[model samples]
Target: MTDTDLEIFAVAPPGLEPALLPEFRALGYKDARYGAGGVTMMGGWADVWRLNLELRGATKVLARIGSFRAMSLAGLDHRADEFPWDETFYSGTTVRVEATCKRSKIYHAGAAIERVERALLKAGMKPSADGEVTLKVRIEQNIVTLSVDTSGESLHKRGHKEAVGKAPMRENLAALFLRQAGYDGAEPVLDPMCGSGTFVIEAAEIAEGLQAGRSRRFAFETLASFDAVDYKALRRAVSVVKGPARFFGSDRDAGTLKGAVANADRAGLSAICDFQCKPLSELKRPDGAAGLVIVNPPYGGRIGDKKQLYALYASLGTAMKTQFSGWRVAIVTSEPGLAQATGLPLSQGPAIPHGGMKVWLFQTPPLK
Candidate 1:
């Protein structure tokens, strides 16, 4: 494909296409289309780096190198060998090949992988049995598409949060929820049930102007044509400004509170965040100021029984109405009925698909 004709893939939370589309457009990507797991746009590799660094809701960014119709194993081998594998794969680097085939003559994924590997070997590039550079091959309806994973280890693992509580929200989902709640780092943000403080940490990072990818290396860095100096220059150009991040996360579980603190410290955000071990009954608004309150309460399967979780939701709702007047509230839950238990007038925000769970983001207007 030409440099201007790149196929860019951005993985988003399920059902968040409407919310995330504007974000892609804001980044200058056009012709955006929704796919099964995320969205596809036509852009170059530079857009991939910008998405990974700037897009808060994206789970991963991939560049589609090429696609062709492959009717049989021989066709797959021919197509694989025809690509410039030498330009993509380094001689000493180990490459991991992952393939998925559906309703195609090349149904045997193992055979397809073998042929692809053989072709790579013929190109004088050795594939390590255990390596970081991953090549993802997807075959469906006699069509095969080859893509190189630009973001390794999923962008959600932002290199913080060494310890996570049960049923912790991924960083990408947390950022999406924050965006849905109208969090722009200018207002005070609180996570009352902040297990491992994912929301608060993301908020702090945004408020502080931190680059999400600064702490980690991306797979694109290993590409043959990738310019390390240019990447560093681009990274340096992304300015980070420290701001008053009125971000707070409180959990009754002391262990989770500790985890949040540790994560914030590692992320260089401890000074900007306030972590506490406090119950919902004692939860107070930050300095009695109107801000955003986002909570991911205990779902039935994870920490509490169904009956107890219902009570938790009920109490959470009561507290929000009684104590958090004029504060916008966003609650994330797998159970829609539990949101009803909150007893607050909530408008359904979005039903985001996450990790095989269909989750609803419920929002309530600021209590008068």
Candidate 2:
């Protein structure tokens, strides 16, 4: 493929590919479709930059540069040397190479990595364990696929949220979960167990039409293909439309609420986001039109005792039933029983891996 025509992959947490695809499609990637662990589409370097800046559900964006078949380490080195690395990477750029082999004659990943590193070094690149940019080599069935991690840090960082609470939901996953719950920034959003204000702040940012990567620097900036002038113009062209929906969050832990407020302020969403110290039992629907109530509660697996979490979840259910009429609800928890304890008419969604545990999103239609 030419420099202007390249394969772009948006990596997401396993099982969230479906949730991430619509985002690319909505952003004008008509050919975008879900893959095993993410979504893949064909575009140039500019698309790579835009995806890194705009995709909220992606954990990172990978640019599939090129690939070749290599049955042996010697062959791998030969092919790597033949490939045009100078086209995308600048000499002396610090990089780390990672490899995975499956059902391939080149079974040793270390050997494969060494071959690739040697080739890179021959091309004037510096190979370091602590490199800022990563090159992923996947050899499956004797076919090698080369991809660069265009996002240096995970996209979840968002370069904001200076503080985080215990077992906080990541920003990318929170955005995808909000989308899965049918939230589109058109209605108010409430998170009763808000920790660090990830959900509320993400919703507020989405409502304000803020760019996901506005505050961050991407790995693509170091690549030879990057265009600072073009990227700056792209960033400048994104205009924010202040949505009318208000985002609210509450938690019994006053200290956590304090941090959440700080996070909202850092995200520049404090104007539309309201944080308070309150328990689930004290949760009341906002005065505005009904919207979405999304929460990530303690499931015994991570934070609290299972037996006690059921009661907390039950209390959350009671609050929604009594006060949040016509508002949709989504609860993220590891235990199906904890979600069932909510006792709301819920639908269990695909299991998503989070913080060393598997969690599912349990949602409901508008509460009658």
Candidate 3:
């Protein structure tokens, strides 16, 4: 926190580690590499802000403030008191303390939380049962580590898309899927069953080079190291330019299409995005270079029986093969049988966990 060399952790969606690694390195963190659940990099508070603001694939950012060794509750209280509170937390701020302990003398997390809370209260910080600022205390093998959750809400919220269709894909996951599908922001993107427009909107943002967290607020603003003037300067340097390539999204439900349009408008991408009520059976190739088409169609238990969904997938496959010559396709679904029913030459994609269901992106070479 006070130190400019604190470790910053960027949480990535499971199965996208390789995709996230190159992103952090290209963002100038040479030390950025894959960690257990995310990518670990060395940076200060400003870097945390930058990651929260700009990184599209990271679902959350955690800043490791400091650490110590405490074998007993007395020892923990003593060490927590000496932490430089003035450098990280504002005085009189309400905060919540959450602790986890394993294989340590201070094995009781509740007792550990009480000790930390008492220390923070002694340092003029108020304790709130539920607070925006969270103090994560971890004790393992006689070592204690403390960190802060910089992103207020999950980064996937992205402060856009108020209307979400049933089983809507998270924004960050959509971005990673786009990258894995080989989208470089230079080509058109379409989603035949675009429920609330997550893929298409994410594509438009990537094409326009817009920051993912541009319209969002963060919990880091409540911390002591936050510099309002510096943050404003950082935002001033962000340039947004709409690209010429248009993104298209269509759904059979007119109400669903309306929600997609509203979400696009909120993201400031309505100008280059086209939405209409169209079913997969009638999906036609747009007049342009055949680009990538990514879709997360409804899969099992929520929409229809396996037999019915097979027909939908078959219709999608037939449409792509018949009309979309030279177009690449990515179909995300939880049912393998449905994917196979498409009848297109599909390569097995990595299995990504989505909404508690394991989904894979079945990709095809350009339709011949």
Candidate 4:
């Protein structure tokens, strides 16, 4: 809320940096950098709204309100009050505060939240009785920083996949992996190991140019001074295109495939996607056009037994080599050894963090 352009922080699962960087760039955010769990870019309150409405791979977008040196509770209180809370939070709206302290005299996180809440109350806004609209605070190296979260829930909840199968990949991560696999609305795409069809669903959405944030509401809408006109205009400009970039998802589990079909239908993308029950060992190239094959196979620790998982990976590798020629391949796995067993000539892409495990995005060249 200061005269200076706001510093916005966007968080994602780690290895997704490569795929997410392009999305930031496409949004005209040039001065941005990646961090351990997310990306930071320079923008204003408007950018925060745009990001919440547009970014497909981002988990949460935070508006960096301010940062200042604070050594004690008094210093924290003064800094918290200095921010123009009235300009952001409305009198009727509810606000929740959370804090983290490191190596600071005001080490008590509860004390910091109380100070922040007092400041907001003084500006005429009440704290949420139910603890909603969370404001994330971090104090490190004696500097206190405050951020307003724009996405109330994580952006990965696309609201369509209600019945996910075992070891389901998140929609945000699936979109990032597909982009990292070079899916640019050109060729057909295949997710041979697609469990609940997240990858294929995302691919269909992207190919049709549908905005991922359209079906969801962002926390930014709760702000007192938020301009709805711009948001409405942006949404109006988003339209789905009809094209030939077919998306296909298959799984050995027929029940999961049925769930995938239901999910795709619920997403309004059944026309653009094909879901079927097919084992990886029996996967064959589609007859018409070349495409990219992306798979989020179950890593051993998460779902199936280790021996079965290793055999699955090996058989998947063999099937890809024999059947999916001239097609690009990308596999998301936490186990390097399992990825190595794929037998594809792979170079590590990016290291992303998901579900407390470090996931690697590995890519193999298009078959000759």
Candidate 5:
């Protein structure tokens, strides 16, 4: 495939593909479509870099290098050897090859990995356990699709949130949740039960028009198609958005609030982010244009007891109804009963797999 016409896939958290699709379309990828696990579109290497740098909801950006039909391991080896690996990787680059086989003659994943790694060795690229780049080989129905993980680390690691509380929300997932809650960075956001300030920081960054990957290094930087000058221009082209909206977060634990403050500072969003050490009972609506109250609270696990959490959710509901008139609310939890305790006019979104359990986003329209 030519560098200008590569298939780019942005991996999304399962069940949030709908929320992520619009973000791609919003960025001018009109043909971006939702697949089983993510979104896919055709773009050049520059588009790959831009997606990695700008899209906050994607977990990984993969470039489909090429695909070929191989009926057996020997044929796979032949095709792999003939494929132009030098076009993607520089000579002697360390890479990790992971293979998955389904409905194919080459059913053994280990054997397929061996063949691909052997081909890489012959191509002068070293296959190591701790490789900087990851090459994913998927063999399904005799079609071998070779894709490179252009995002070395998960996009969730925006590289600034160093301190996170127990079961803290992932940034990418938080961004998707915000979008699901109808947040567009035009209004203020408040996370009453914020831990390590993920939602608050993400909302602030969106409001300020900050690039998601501004502080992180990407695997694409090491690829042969990467142009440093073009990337720098892409980074510089993003203009910071100034708005009247502000983001706020509060937690009962002062220690957690400290970390949240530090996280916002590291993200260069301290000016727009405000963290307070307050209980759910004390969460008041900020004095200004009402926006969204997005929260991820405990669900009877290590965070709190199930029985007691009902009261907490009820308190949250009471606070929202009494003090936060005209603002929208979104709560994420694994239990429907907990959400019911809130007594808010809520609608449930798709079940999202988070922290080893299926959780959901429950949202309410602007309260009267």
Candidate 6:
């Protein structure tokens, strides 16, 4: 968190690393590349600020502040307490400490967390039993690396979209999925099972050339290293070019549709989004050019019968075949069997973690 350039990690949902790498490259991040858990690159405070602000696919952006070797609890305690806490955090700030131990002599993660918390307490910082800012420690082979959670509430919160429906796709993941479907600005987009209209709304934002962080706040804004003037300038630097595209979303639930409308309105995207209380079997061709049709249909865990989900998927596939030809398709489902029931000639990405379930993206070329 100094003026010197440092490492930045854009944490992606597991298995979506490939999907997120191009996004960082497009943003012009230096040495932008994907690793096991996320994308990593080097930057300064400004870059740290930008990633937390702009990245749509990152679940969190962690700034690797510093590291040390801690063979024992006492070693961890001494170095953690002596680390320059004042440089990054505001005085009297409350911080939560989280640690992970692997292949290390200090194998107890909870004990490691206690020692780090103790260090922070003695350094004039309060140990928040609950708070946003966190001091994350990773212990491996007796090496301890310390970093701060620059994204306070996880980037998916986005500050907008207040009314989230049951098992809604996170805005970050929605944005990345849209990108994976090869969605750019000009083409229209549709989400038939649009829970809270995340997919449609995110597509509209991208089409309108909006910054993902436009309506959000980041934890970096609360840090001592933050520069208000420079941040303001960066915010102002976003250029927008409104497109002629309209994004469409529909669901059977009236309450869900209403929530989607309100969420879109809050995000200033109601003008470019359409929401309706209509089931998939009743869907028709939207009044526009062919585009992408992305849906996160009921995975049947908490709603409806799993036995009937196959029939629902079959019906959806038939509906798409009859109504949405020439439009590509992307469906996210926890059940590969249910996805196969679609019979949509689909290809899948790696199963990704979502709401404690592993969901895969089943995609198809435009219908004949």
What TM-score does each of the candidates earn? Answer: 0.93, 0.96, 0.95, 0.92, 0.97, 0.94
Off by over 4 Å in 2: 1-4, 237-245
Per-model lDDT: 0.81, 0.90, 0.87, 0.81, 0.91, 0.85
The CA root-mean-square deviation of candidate 6, after full C-alpha superposition on the true structure, stands at 2.0
Tens-digit lDDT track of model 3 for 1-368: 34458899889998887777877876788878896678998888888888898888888899988899998999998999998876788889888888999999999999999999998899999978787788889999989999898997889998877988887889999998898899988999989999999999999988887888988899899999899987876673435445454899999988878999999888888888999898887788899888999999888856667677888888898888898899999998898888898898989888887787789988988889
Q: Which candidate wins on lDDT? A: 5
lDDT of 2 by residue, 1-368 (tens): 56457989899989999999998988899998897989999899989998988899999999999988988888998999998888878999988999999999999999999999999999999999988799999999999999999999999999888888988999999999999999998889999999889999999888777889998899999999989998887784434334443999999999989999988777767768888898877787889789999999999876888988888888889999999999999999999998998789999999898888899999999999
**Residue ranges of candidate 3 with Cα displaced over 4 Å:** 1-4, 236-245
Clash count in backbone of candidate 5: 0
| Pairs that collide, model 6 | none
Task: Give the poorly placed runs of model 5, Cα more than 4 Å off.
Answer: 1-3, 237-245
Tell me the TM-score of model 1: 0.93
Clashing pairs in 4: 14-352, 14-353, 15-351, 15-352
lDDT of 4 at 345: 90
Q: How many residue pairs clash in each candidate?
A: 0, 0, 0, 4, 0, 0
- Per-residue alpha-carbon lDDT of candidate 6 for residues 8-110, written as tens digits (9 for 90 to 100): 8889988889889988878886488898999988889888888877788999989988999989999988898899988877778888888899999999999
Clashing residue pairs in candidate 3 (N, C-alpha, C atoms within 3 angstroms): none
Mark the regions of model 1 whose C-alpha exceeds 4 Å error after superposition. Answer: 236-245
List of clashing residue pairs for candidate 5? none
Model 4 lowest lDDT segment of ten: 236-245
**Model 6 off-target regions past 4 Å?**
1-4, 237-245
Q: Could you tell me the lDDT of residue 176 within candidate 3?
A: 88
TM-score winner among the candidates? 5
lDDT of 4 by residue, 269-308 (tens): 8777887798876787777777888888889767777667
> After TM-score superposition, what is the CA distance of residue 3 in candidate 2 from its true location, in Å?
5.9
